[model samples]
Every structure is written in C-alpha cells, then in structure tokens.
Target: MSTLQIGVLFGVVTFIALFSGMPIAFAVGGVALTFMLIYMPAETVGLVAETLYSELDNFVLLTIPLFVLMGAAIGKSRAGGDLYASLNRWMGRIPGGLGVANVMACSVFAAMCGSSPATCSAIGSSGIPEMRKRGYSPALAAGIIAAGGTLGILIPPSLTLILYGVVTEQSIGKLFMAGVGPGLLLTALFAVWVVIRFRQEKARVLAGDESGATREILREEGFTWREKFETLPRLAPFIGVIVIIMVALYGGWATPSEVAGIGAFFSLLMVIVIYKCWRWPDLKAILGGTVRESTMVMMIIATSFLYTYVMSYLHITQEVAQWLVALPLGKWGFFVAANILLVVLGFFLPPVAIILMVTPIILPALKAHGIDLVWFGVIMTILMEMGLIHPPVGLNLFVINSIAPDIKLRDIIWGTMPFIGLMVFAIFLLAVFPEIAMWLPQNVK
Candidate 1:
C-alpha cells in the first residue's frame, strides 16, 4: 500500500480505538504495530523498542512522576483541605465568597499540582461540601469546582506544558513561565464571574427579605476567622514544596527532572514527618497508587510513540504540514485554524493525545509561518483547558461530578459556559498580543 493509504488506515484505527473505550496507550500502540507488521520489515520491531526507550529516557519526563507524587501526597495529606478552609473563612462573607475561594484555592493548588483530575479531586472534596453547607446549590458548587479544576493545565508546573515542551523540543522552563500570566488572568475572570453571581443572589434575597436574621445565622453556623488562621500552618509544607521546585528551576540550579526528584522527595518527607499524615502502611499504599497512575501515563506515552513513529514513517505528518503551509492563510489564519482544530480534537482525545498527534504536524506549519512557539504552546494549553470543560467527554466535568454525584451533568456543563467564554477571551488576548505569553520568558533571566 502507498504510504498515504497506510496513514489513512492508521488514522481510522486510532479513532475507532479511542471511541471504543480502549485505553489511549493501547490504541496508539496497537494501530502502530498493525501498520508496522503489515507494511514495514519484520526488523522494524527494533525501531519500536528504540522509540519507547528514547522517549521515556528523557530527563524532563522525570518531572511528570515527581509532580504527580507531590500532588498525590498533598491531596492525601489534606493540606489542600486546610488551604480551602482558610480561604473560605476569609472570603465567605462576600456574596459567593465560598465560590470565589474555591476558584482561588484551585488556582493555588494548580500551581503545585499540574494534573486536572488531581486538582478536581483535591479541591472538589473540600470545596463542594463546604459550599453545599453554605447553601450554595450543588450545581453551582460542582460547576465552580469543575471549571476551577481546569486551571491545572494552564498554571505553572503543568504536566501538559512539560509534555508539550518535551514533544516540541521547546524550553519547558520558558513554557512554565509563559503560562504564569495567562493562568492568573483566567483565574481572575472566574473570580469575577463568582462575584457577579453572588451579588445577583444577594440582591434577590434582600429584595424579598428572604435572608435569615443575622443572629439566626450566627447561631446556626457563623463564620469563624479563628479556624482560618489555625488552618494556615497546615499549608506550609505544600508551600515549601512549591517554593523549592520553582526556585530550583528558575534559579538555574537544577533541571526540571532533578527538581521533580527533589520535589517528590520533599513531598514524601512532608507527608511522613511534617503532616504525619502517612505511616508505614500508608506509605506503601501511596507508592502503589503513584505506580498505578504513573504506569497508566507511561503506557499512553509509549503507545503515542508508536503512533508517532508510524505517522512519521508514512510521511503523513510531513504531507499534512506541507498541505497546511500551502494554504492561502497567513500566520494569523493558521493560528486561528489550529486553535479551532485543537478544540474540536480535544473533545475526543486527552490533551496528551491531542498534543502528540497534532503538534508534530501543525508545529512545522506554524513555524514556517513565523509563529512564536512559546506563544503557541500557551494558546494550545488554554484551548486544552477549554477541552477539559467541554461536553461529551470533558475530563474535568466527570471528575467534579464523580465527587459530587448530586450535581447533574447539565448543570456542570452550563456553569462552565461563562468560564469558557473567559478562556476564549484569554486566547484572543494571547493571539493578538503574543507578548502576554512571551514577555516573561524573554525578560526573565
């Protein structure tokens, strides 16, 4: 078969496997193997081995496990709960105060934990219950947590940024720096939406005098500043971990991999010594969980390698790149088209899968058009953030809903609309003013 025909077949097989509920790693691996066995030489097996080894052997990939372990340890240690409680007490008096706190807490946690589900699981566990007790509708609570969860990808230390840097050979440190401003911008937008919603609710309640008497609320469950300060110390270890990693990376003292190792070590130490949250038995369980999660991610990476190999071998990526570049659109047109395509693909594939599959093809076209890669990475990360909240298969929606089963899927979907609009606004800002993502990376060090 012609290489083009082989590429077409590979694409079809990959789509089928993805929608059929098969694991992404296996899907990519299986499709690649089929093509390699049928069309390539039998000795091509060596190439697969080489691809797996080379991809996994990277120093940067170590950061993934370290970041994952840090996130898991913090989650299990209940530091995140403390952080949220602290914020809640301080912000709770404001209309939708708890909701605003939820977004703020998630943004803080996202800086430390780069995974979306981990962010959702950690914050949703505490934020949802607190908001529910405060009389916030489960839908509103779930929606806020779900949307806030997506900050995981846009914020610093983002695994998605790491993967994008690794795949595209961009500077991971620069990518992390580039994300800082945009991440904060999105978080601020979410906060504004919360405040607006809260004000509307408060106005309606006062208009009807539906609010309970102040003494009644005080007697029932008054706000407590005392608990807020008491909970502040519990966040120290997490803060320490983040500071160490960021300092190490930004100070040129350590590579991302080395910093990840340091971060993981400190995280383990914090859980065992500082928090006293994990004993010997709990340590074993945590390790087991980390292994399981790491293995799943690694498997996906391995399979994606196979898929990338086959696509390259068939020249599909090259053909697509050439085709895209030949189009009449200029740099801006290509940027818009790429964003739209990624948003569409994100609905079906995980961010890793989308990045791995499309970037190899689109990046060449982007560079040929004189686009800034760091800027593109930030834009893509924001688009992927949107994907996590989008319908049909948004990972964040499922995560929050899983924690708050009382929330209907429709409610979670509807809540994200405003946040999604904000994200689109951020994307436009980045596109029109590339410096939003580029300025820091350029000026820093």
Candidate 2:
C-alpha cells in the first residue's frame, strides 16, 4: 500500500480503537504492533521492543511516579479538606465567594497534586457539599469544580508539564516557571467569571428576575480574621510542601527527580504525622493508588513512543512536518492550526498520550517557525485542561459526577462549557502577549 494510504488508515483505525472503549494502553500498543508487523519486515519487530525499553529509560521520568505518590498521599489524607476550610473562611464571605473559594482551593490543590482527577475529587468532595448546603446552586457548585479542576494540569508540579518536558526536552524547571503566570491568570479568570455570574444573579434578584433566596446567600455571614487564621495550622504543612517544591526548583537546589523524591517523602510524612494516617490500610491505600496511577501513565508512555517509532518509519512524521511548513500560514497561523489539532486529539486521548505521540511529528515545524517550546508547552497544557472538562472522555467531568452523584452529568457538562471559552481566551491572551507565560521563566535567575 502507498504511504499516504497507510498514514490515513492509521489515524482512522486508531481513532476507532481509542473511541471503542478499550484501554488506552492496549489500543495504542495494538495499533503500533499491527502496523509494525504488516508494513515492516519481521526483523523490525525487534525495534518495537527496543523502543519500549528506551522510552521508560529516562531518569527524568522518575519525577512522574514520585509526584504521583505525593499527590496520592495527599489525596488519601485530610489536607484537602483543611485547605478548603481555610480558604472558605477567608474567601467565602461574599456572595458566590464559596464558588470563588472553590476555584482558589482547586488552584492550591492543583499545586499539591498535579493530577486533574485527584484535584477534582479532593476539592469537589468538600467543596461541592459545602457550596450546596450554603445556598449555592447545584450547577454553580458542580460547574466551578469541574472547571476549576483543570487547574491541576496548568499549575506548578504539573504532570502534563513534566510529560511535555520529557517529550520536548525542554527544561522542566523553566517549564514549571512558565506555568506560574498562565496558571494564576487562568485561576483569576475562573474566579472572575464566578464573581460576574454571582453579580448577574444578584442583579436579577434586585429586579425580581429570579427568586430572592439568593439574597441571603449574597449576605453570607462573614468570618472574623481570627477564625480565618485558626485553620492555618491545619493547612500549613500542605502549603509547606508547595513551598519546598518551589524553592527546590527555583533555588536550583535539586534536580526535578530529586525534588520530587523529597517532596513525596515529606508529603507522606506530613499526612502521617498531622493527619495521623499511620494505619496499615491508610499506608496501603496511598501506595496502591500511587502504583496504579504511575503504572497507567508508564504504560501509556511506552505505547505512545512505540507508536511514534512507527510514525517515523512510515515517513508520516517527516511528511507532516513538511506539509506544515508548506502552508502559507505564518507563525501565528501555525499556532492556530496546531491548537485546533491539539484540541481534537485531546478530546479523544489524555494529555500524556497526545504529548508523547504527537510531539515527535510536529517538533520540526516548531523549530522551523522558531516557536518557543516552553511557550508551546504552556499552551498545550492549557488545551489539555480544556479537554479534561470536555465531553466523551472528559476526565474531570466524570470525576465530579462520580463524587457528586446527585449532580447529573449534563449539569457538569453545562458547568464546564463556559470555562472552555475562558480557556480559549487564555490561549488568546498568551498568544498576543507571550510574556504572560515566558516572563517568569525568562527573568528568574
């Protein structure tokens, strides 16, 4: 068969397989194996084995499991609940403040755990029920979390950024630095949207456009400063973890792997000591969750590299790069096209798979256009955040639905719809002014 025919078939069949409900690792691995056998000679099959081995051979990949363990330990602990309580007391005094606080808490928790589903689960567990009881609408409660949870991937210590670093060979520390500005920008954007929605609701009530019960919510009871400070000791340990990671990375005191190791150990220790999660089962649960998540990511990474190998062998990668360069579209035009492709791939595949599998094919074009890998990494991570809130495979959406079973899937979907636009606007802002994501990474010593 012709190379073009092979390339087209590969995408179509892979899409069908991925969308068919099979495990992502199997679907991706299966595609790689099938194509390797049919197109290449039997001897080339050995290369597939070699490719799988080399993919996981990097020392930097160690960061992923360690970070995952840190997140898992936190996820299994009471730190998340404490953090939410602290923020709510301080930020929840205003009408819709709880929702804003949820966004803020999600951003904080995202730094604690780089996994989106973990962020969604942790914050939504406490945030949702609390918001509902305090007169917050179910849609507002669920939507805020589903949208806020995307912060997990954009903020520092993020797995998506780690994976992007691994694939693109960008400086992980610099990438982490790059994420800070955009992360805060998105957090503010999400919070601002919440504030506006509440204002609109209050305006409606004043005009008798809606019910008046929301007025009482608008007059939410305020907490004293002392009360706000009281919850800090409970949360200080978790915040300390974030500080250690930041200082370690920014201070140049440790490599990404070393920082992850230290952070994970301390996070585990903090939970055990402060949260008293010392029982055998608690330890077992944290370790087991870490292994499960880390293994799944490793499996995806392995198959994605193999698929990348086949793409290169089929001349698909070279063809695509050349095709991209041939476009009359300039640099900005390329960004537009690339963003669209990333969004579509994100809808079907998780960020990890897309990063590993797609990056190799497009790297040449990025260099040709002189696009900053760090900048592109932040953009890609933001797009991945959108995918987590988006449909058929929206990981965060399902996470919210699972935790808050009372909130229907449709509502969660609706709740996330606006944030998608917000993310798009973020991408726009970053594109127009690259400094938003680059300034920190560039200026920091």
Evaluated at residue 58, the lDDT of candidate 2 is 94
Residues forming the 10-long window of minimal summed lDDT in candidate 1: 213-222
lDDT of candidate 1 over 69-162, digit per residue (tens): 8777777666778778777777766667789989999998888778788889989998888776665655567878888999998888889998
193, model 2: CA deviation in Å?
A: 1.2
- lDDT per residue for candidate 2 within 1-445, as digits (tens), equals 8878899999988988888988899999999899999998899997777889888999999999999999999888888888888888888576678888899999998987888899899999999998777656667788899989889898988899998898888999899999999999999999999988777765665576545244244435488889988988977887788899889888989988899998999999999998899999999999999999999999998998888888888998888889998888999899899999999887778888788888888889999998999999999999999889898788988899899998889888887888999999999999999999999888986
Alpha-carbon error at 418 in model 2, in Å? 1.9
Model 1 compared with the native: what TM-score? 0.93
Candidate with top lDDT is 2
Give stretches of model 2 more than 4 Å off: 205-218
* Cα error of candidate 2 at position 412, Å: 1.5
lDDT of each: 0.81, 0.88
Give the Å shift of residue 83 in candidate 2: 0.8
